[model samples]
Target: MEILDHLDKLKIFIAVAQRGSISAASQELALTQPAITRAIQTLENAAGYPLFTRNRSGMQLTQGGQILFETAGRVLKEVSDATLRGAHVRTEMAGTFTIGTYESLAEYLWPDFLLKVQKDYPLINLSIRTDSQRSHLEELNNGTLDLLVDAEPRHRQNLAMWPLYTDRFSFYATKAATELNPETAKNLTLLYVRNAFDEDNVTIESHLKSAGYQFQQEYTFDSFTTVKRMAEKGLGIAVLPQRLADKEGKLKLIKAKGFKEGFGHHGIFATVSPHRENDRRIKTVVNLLRKQLS
Candidate 1:
């Protein structure tokens, strides 16, 4: 069997064993249930034995599965450490670097970042994963993500974070929408990304709350692009990052009494799993990104 394919199967097996169910592993890894099940079956076929005993209680790993889990885990860790160590000694950044971040920032930064990195380090392979949510430490800890650029998460002790820059947020609406002073701002409908309310690191709700505006009507969207588009069509006032808001010519930035200064700025961070703190290739990527933004 190919080493890469074997390692991929091992990863699926480890996730299943740790999560105790195929459904949970599928959810965590963003794979379909059948795909995860097929990986397990393929691994079992290769081993010439059943790895998990199926039951209502959940999958119980057999002796072979337990042995494979312990050994494969060590092998994965060792391979990662060796790769990072080699990267540290190399003169040029070369190797696969996977990064994750929020979609809004990715939309603004990724195209330029990708071009600059490829121009400087042609040998390096870069992969980017963008999501609407703020918490990606799970992917980082699992070794699927090499680096992340986002607002610092609330539970931050698990990963090492380097503060990159701050991006302020503000209220915006279509130019045709009703004028919003402090008194009128509270009456206008609100539209925003759903993660803004759910994530502790994001302060959209906090800013509105402090301004004493308890919006009676609100629209939540998963995409900042969509939120901005809706706001431009006179749907509602959207709370958006300053950079994103500035790009929309049809949208007018609100200058209410309490919010004239902008909602607030959150520090964007370049983060990695603590184990990669000393890896030079990763550091180079982070520094290049900082320079691109600067």
Candidate 2:
């Protein structure tokens, strides 16, 4: 006989043995008396021996029934304990959290946020990936990222985005160019990161156009690192995220008059799949970023 098939029989047998009466066990289990009697019969048949001695007043467990009672009680307790432990483990924020970010924020913001998370939740194994804004959204849709940090995109579907912070784009140049004002901004040689500003993707190009200014010498690069380095070497005034520009500490912020009036700042946001927004571990990390980076 298979032990698994007889588990219900064992449970009823244990209940009957402990209660000392079939009717009493039936009441305790909310089972009909006939059902209880049938379960006891099944237990006896499986055991190949009489389990309970029935009498007018009550029932008594035979030697085999007594042995099963002891074993079943322990088994039930162990199973229940295992279930509770499993539940506890599920509640802990101890799992992989994969986050995707753009190059600038990944370089500027994530280092301090990571330190705080490690100190608080050491068990949250973290993985960070840097991608362009468009690529980040693609990976997020394909389920490759658990959380995302980037400039606010124009469209969001099946995703929840929360505003984290705003970063302004500013012109940075060598100390010699600090004397160059907004009226002459068009005269300065300018370094541009091609991916950083596009007419459809970012507002910088339109803002610069409205100011009646244009770069006299234009150098375009693919990466912000290159843009900043070239600007530091005094090749041109580079327009980059104010935070990233500040971090370089090598260039001076050249504030043009009326420059602050045009598309000055863009919002940065934290995004997650709609279903995972409320998850404890994901929420914890998002909250940590909002708190630390705000």
Candidate 3:
């Protein structure tokens, strides 16, 4: 007989062994007493040996029944454990989530979102790593990161993305440097983040190139924080996301006439493997991010 055919019989056998009576087992299992007896008989026929002996007081287990009872008890315990584990995962009750994002987003966007996640999922341990967009995407593909936030979404068959928020880019410098015109400013030291360049960078570069002004790159940093620090220290004028510039409060937004189109807006996106798209933890994080962005 198929193993599946013996499952119901095994269940009844276990129940009777636990309750020590067919009547009690039947009530516990929500089956009629006769039905429980029939199930026990089916198990005996399958095993080629009787599992229980009936007495005036109740049913008692035979030697073979005792062995099967122990085995069944272990199996039932495993089944219960598996059920609970699945429920916990579905509810996002526990697990560690590794998140990756570019430096700019990590600095500007993740503070509040991290606090909210901690409040909502006390059991979920979050590990965050900040890197360049390209490196973040590579880590995500290699399973090092469960999710990634980047200025631009990666184009890959196994990855999915969604827009988080859009922010404009702007040119900024310290108030002491306000007297420098855009042309003269290009001749001064200019700090740039090579890895964090997005579509906005392209627009800004083109506008500057067309204006016959070329910036003399004095320093190149891999992080936005470094570039912002350099600009605030009066080391150079830099192009920065408007939100960061506004938050810093140390830099003044340049109001040059032709530079308006240079402030391109970018949509932040979440990147993750398609296989993990339906994971409860990932879905919860995505929902929270969407809410924060909205």
Which number leads on lDDT? 1
Pairs that collide in candidate 2 are none
The candidate that wins on TM-score is 1
Residue-level lDDT tens digits of model 3 in 1-294: 533568756777766875679889988899999999888888888777888898898888899877776566445534544465566765545666778876666776788888988898776667788765666664565455778877756466768886777777667788744444556756777666544545445544555556565666657776667788888888877777777777759988776546654456666878887767887668878889889776
TM-score of candidate 2 relative to the true fold: 0.63
Candidate 2: lDDT over CA atoms? 0.72
Evaluate all candidate structures by whole-model CA lDDT and list the values in order. 0.75, 0.72, 0.71
**In model 1, what are the clashing residue pairs, if there are any?**
none
lDDT of 1 by residue, 1-294 (tens): 533456767777878887789999999899999999999998888888889999998887898877776566545755765586476665456667778898777777889889988888776778898753433555566565788887645557767888787767778877644445556765778898755632345457666767677665889887777888898788888888877788637788777667666756656788887888988878888888888777
Candidates ranked by TM-score: 1, 2, 3
Of 1 and 2, the candidate ahead on lDDT is 1
Off by over 4 Å in 1: 1-8, 11-91, 132-135, 176-179, 194-202, 214-216, 248-250
